[model samples]
Target: MKKQEQDHQKKNPIYQEYQLNLNLYNKGKTQLGIEFLI
Candidate 1:
């Protein structure tokens, strides 16, 4: 079940966006990273 969920996220756009967000979050500021959710 967990693996299936992980695989689903791998192909999901929202998840991809979240990954971009996490990258930005890890890079520096919080404001721009939060904006990715919207």
Candidate 2:
């Protein structure tokens, strides 16, 4: 049941967008660190 829910979320486009937004926000916070992380 837990695995099924996790899989569903992974397939969700909204989830991917949210992840991207978080990453972008992180980059905005630390432009220099983001260069190394990416």
Candidate 3:
């Protein structure tokens, strides 16, 4: 399941967008774990 999620994130733009948002969130407030939820 985890591997599939990783592969999906690599191929899907929506996932990539979420990843960017995750990065920004991590940078701004350091929650750091939101990327996985996204």
Candidate 4:
């Protein structure tokens, strides 16, 4: 079922790492944008 797949993703270390990287990338982008605006 779809719920089982979601659970599997939650347990996956690679996926977790990818998500953390994605968050950092987004934060970096936001900071760059603010610097450009100011």
Highest lDDT against the true fold, candidate? 4
lDDT of 1 by residue, 1-38 (tens): 69999899889999899999889878766666778767
Query: Who is ahead in TM-score, 3 or 4?
Result: 4
Identify the leading candidate in terms of TM-score.
4
User: Residue by residue across 1-38, what tens digits does model 2's lDDT show?
Assistant: 69998899889999989989999998788997778799
What are the TM-scores, per candidate, against the unseen true structure? 0.48, 0.56, 0.50, 0.80
Model 3, C-alpha of 31: deviation from truth (Å):
11
Shift in Å, residue 23, candidate 3: 0.6
Q: Identify the runs in model 4 with alpha carbons over 4 angstroms from their true place.
A: none
Error of 1 at 18 (Å): 1.2
Q: Please identify model 2 stretches exceeding 4 Å from their true place.
A: 1-5, 32-38
Which TM-score value belongs to model 4? 0.80
Candidate 4 C-alpha lDDT tens digits along 1-38: 69998899899999989999999999999999999999
- Model 1: weakest 10-residue lDDT segment is 28-37
Worst 10 residues of 2 by lDDT: 27-36
For candidate 2, the per-residue lDDT at 7 reads 97
1-38 in candidate 3: lDDT tens per residue?
69988898799999899989988976866555566567
lDDT accuracy of residue 17 in candidate 4: 95
lDDT (C-alpha) at residue 30 in model 1: 60
The lDDT for every candidate, in the order shown, is: 0.85, 0.90, 0.81, 0.96
